[model samples]
Target chain A: MSVLLSATRISKRFGGVQALSDVEFSIRRGEIYGLIGPNGAGKTTLFNVLTSVYAADDGRFEFDGAPLSGLKPHQVAARGIARTFQNIRLFANLTAIENVMIGRHVRTRAGVFGAMLRTRATRAEEAAIEARAAALLDYVGLAARADDLARQLPYGEQRRLEIARALATEPLLLALDEPAAGMNATETSDLRRLIERIRGDGITVLLIEHDMKLVMGLSDRVLVLDYGRRIAEGPPAQVRTDPKVIEAYLGTGATSATRAHAEPAPAGARPGAVPGAAN
Target chain B: MNRAARPRSPLAALGVILVAAALLVLPFALAQAGTAWVRITNLAILFALLALGLNIVVGFAGLLDLGYIAFYGVGAYVWAMLASPHFNLHLPFWAILPIGALAACVFGVLLGAPTLKLRGDYLAIVTLGFGEIVRIFLNNLSRPVNITNGPQGIARIDPVRIGEFDFSTTSKIAGLTFSGPIKYYYLLLVFLVVVIVLNMRLQDSRIGRAWEAIREDEIAARAMGIDTTSVKLLAFAMGASFGGIAGGMFASMQSFISPESFVLVESVMVLAMVVLGGMGNIWGVVLGAVLLTFVPEILRYTVEPLQKAAFGRTIVEPEVIRMLLFGLALVLMMLFRPSGILPSSARRREREGRQP
Candidate 1:
């Protein structure tokens, strides 16, 4: 499989502390790749770097065979990569449907005069766009709340709406930063299915998730991180049994002490035995 | 999409239409009141345009502009220099209007470019300084054998003429009839209509949505690939162009141009029109402008005459009482309807749905 996005030795530093250091990662076309790590493990920083919200200090990235260094966040988005923020950053005053419609702004060609006159072409395009927005909302179970302001939605619905908005951009690669965070069991399960459906559509997904269950269950390949470095990478079965992965999560001493307790649970065997199973 | 489809509520449409129709006939209905009433009507229409122009900046773009009248001052001074007798210049009104508008747009961009990076209240202060600087420049630049003619102001401003038709109230067209305050009033009404339509179109356009997005969330707007700097400049230029147009009409109507007319208070009055009517709403701001301009004149006549009739002398000076009442009305409106009279439905609903 061709690499859809490739990052070589990416590193980011803020003041004195390093957020991400020497991180080499690649995402292939049509796979749900998961980034799993503990809190402050630099998953979001990596996403930020990939999306060009923050420039990596020591490395570079390429998307779809084009260099992405020194690009603005919007430029990255324009180049067919879309992302959802870990904390839902939405145009809160805008309607739920309007939020999705904005995602289609890159595709809308109507100028100021055309929009003002509501020209035949503008109207046709707008109708088509609205219909697409409506369909996306339905896909995310927000059809009834299309006209409601985004901030009015329940917490879980807001997350889904963000995903819907990102999808409206018609992205080739969707980077979801902790989409299943703060969701209950039912919501997490629903998100896992949604992630699968997204990947099944032949779009590549780079997900940053704390929910080990969802990550281990849904990802085609999982990359583990410890202190801004990739500690392990493999299919869930090999990853779950990797001693480094255990050390990254449970501490070095705990890994050795719990090696007998941790090794038998094959990564692909599902997250039922793990205490902290992710979505 | 159906042009023939009647509005949803006949009674509501009838009420609105009836009021508009009555207002259309107001000049003739108040014809007996002579030129004073006509002047008041003219002033009201100009203010309405001015307010609508400012609305495009502060209301739609969420950029608090305190120097909006600087554009008006620029327009007036530009037109004065081009068409006034002081320079022995005779640019046709049509040509002068565009020049004036262009000058203001250039100045608007010059101001907007550097300050567009500033956020919120700081932008307002910078704009306020810009307005004052323009005013002081006009006041001081008259000395060395007169370029601006200084505090003397500009006189003999040639009236607006269309083709061979002179539109001056004193000059007859084709020896048949002379234009009057009513003619100027109608001309301004046409300008107001054009402005309202343009504003409505702008508000619904993609650029308009980008502005609204910036107003709501700047970071998100930028993330969506909207160029914030270019968009802000467009808002400033578009808003200033209306100020230029209104300045042209004012000069034609008064047949004179002066910097005093574009004072800071005038800027405040235009802004008051937007806030009092509802910012970001076209019709509401127009109504607010008309009310603010005309109500004071009406009160001046009624309050003094009524007091004199009852007390054999004026009980309260009309000027002071009018200001007091106007101030109180603004205060009450701000307290009661901060969103203005015809708040956008989206905004009203948002306010209503906010958590306590």
Candidate 2:
């Protein structure tokens, strides 16, 4: 499979803290790529750098064969990379459908004159955006909640809505930051199905997840990070048992955190006891 | 957006017709009691234009612009310079209004470019400074170039003319005599209606959604591929253009201009109209502007007269009392209806979400 996005020698610093150093990974098109790490593993920093939320101190990126460094977050989006925040940065006041419609903004061509006059083309475009937004909402199983304000959505629905909004951008790569952060087992499984379904529809997903079951069972490949550096990367089966990953997790209290995440979950469902949900 | 989905109520339609009929005839009725009331109504319409313009910035885009009146001043000065005898140039009203709008739009871009990074209180302070700077320039540019004519102001400015029909002249139309104020009233009403329609249309469009997104969460908006800078600049440009058009109309209607007319207080008053009536709701802003305009006029007639009847001499200036009441009304409105008299749908959502 051709690689869709590749980062080389990425580094970032926050004053005295080295957020990321020489971290590198490439995401192949049409695969679920998981990024796993403990707390302060620089997973978020790498996500931010890839989205151009922060300029990498030293790095070069190639996305779909185009250089993707020094671009703004909007530019990153325009280049077909759409992301959801870890803490859910939704347009809280907007309706669910409106939020999705905003995701179609980069693709729309309306301007002030067109909007004010509402020309024929503008009308057609608006109708299409609404239709697509509604369809996306339905795709994420929140069709009934399309009219509700985004903040009014239940926890699982809000996550679904964010995914819907991100999908509306028609991204080549959907970067989800901790999708299962607040989900119960059922919800996490639902999210897993959704992510798989998205991949089936031909969009690659780059998941930065702390939820172990969802990541290990879902990702085609996994990259492990510890102390701002990549310790191992391979298919999920290989990376989970990597000695370096275990040691790094052990350095920061491994048995409780990484054991449950790196190894498989206990067979029975834990209901609301999602390890990452505590975050 | 839901406006098209929901069927219009018959009662609401009837009320709209009644209001339209009243608006059409009220100026003529007021002319019987002398043209002063009509003129006041005309000014109210003018301020409505200003309020609608400022709404684009403060309400739609969620940018706090205290320098909004500077665009109005720019438009007024553009008209005064090109259309008036002060510069010996005579561009027609139609041509001058567009030029004035364009000039204001350019200035809007200029202001937006530098202040793109600022938001909230910082934006307010910078905009406030911009408004003051424009006013000061108008007040002092008489020395070297003599452009604005200093504190004496620009006078004998040409009134609005359309196809040999001067708005300043009284003409017998149908069976009724249309005075200058009544003529200006119709003209200003036409402009206000056009502005209101444009505001409504734009409010439901893609660009409007982008603006709201940026206002809600800039980073998320960016993540959605919206260039926040360009969208914010567009908001400023639109707001300034509307202000410019109103400013041009104001200058022509008054047949005079001065720096004092576009002051910091005027900007604050326009902002109050937006906040009080409903920031993002066009009709609400209009209502706020009309109420604000008429309240002071009503107070002028009652307060001093009542004070004179109560005592021998006028004890306190009515202006002082008017300002005090204005402040009180704003504070009370904010405390009671923070979302505004007719809150926008988004604001209504926020307000309702706060409740059980």
Tens-place lDDT digits, model 1, residues B1-356: 11112244578689979987986777666666777898799899999988888998888888988899989878877877787777788898878888888888898898898898887789988988898888888777887767766666788887777777565654444553333776677678788887888787677666677777778777666666566778889889888988887887787667776678777888888888999999888878988998999889999889988998899898789999999999999999999998899886554364335422
Question: For each candidate, what TM-score against the reference?
Answer: 0.88, 0.94
The best candidate in terms of lDDT: 2
Error of 1 at A215 (Å): 2.8
Residues A164-217, candidate 1: write the lDDT tens digits: 888887888998988988999899888888878888887899988877777888
Task: Compose the digit string of candidate 2's lDDT tens values, residues B1-356.
Answer: 43454456699799999999998989878888878899999999989999998998988899999999999999999999988888899899989999999999998998888999999999999999999999999999998989999998898889999888989999998888888888999999999999998988888898889888988999999999999999999999999999999999989888899999999999998998999999788778999999999998888878898899999778889998888887898899999999789888754564344433
For every model shown, the clashing-pair count is 6, 0
lDDT of each residue in A80-195, candidate 2, tens digit only: 99999999999998888899999999988899899888788888888899899999999999988877889989999899999999999999999999999889989998999999
DockQ of each: 0.40, 0.60
How many backbone overlaps does candidate 2 show?
Answer: 0
**Native contacts present in each candidate (fraction):** 0.47, 0.85
* Top-DockQ structure, candidate number: 2
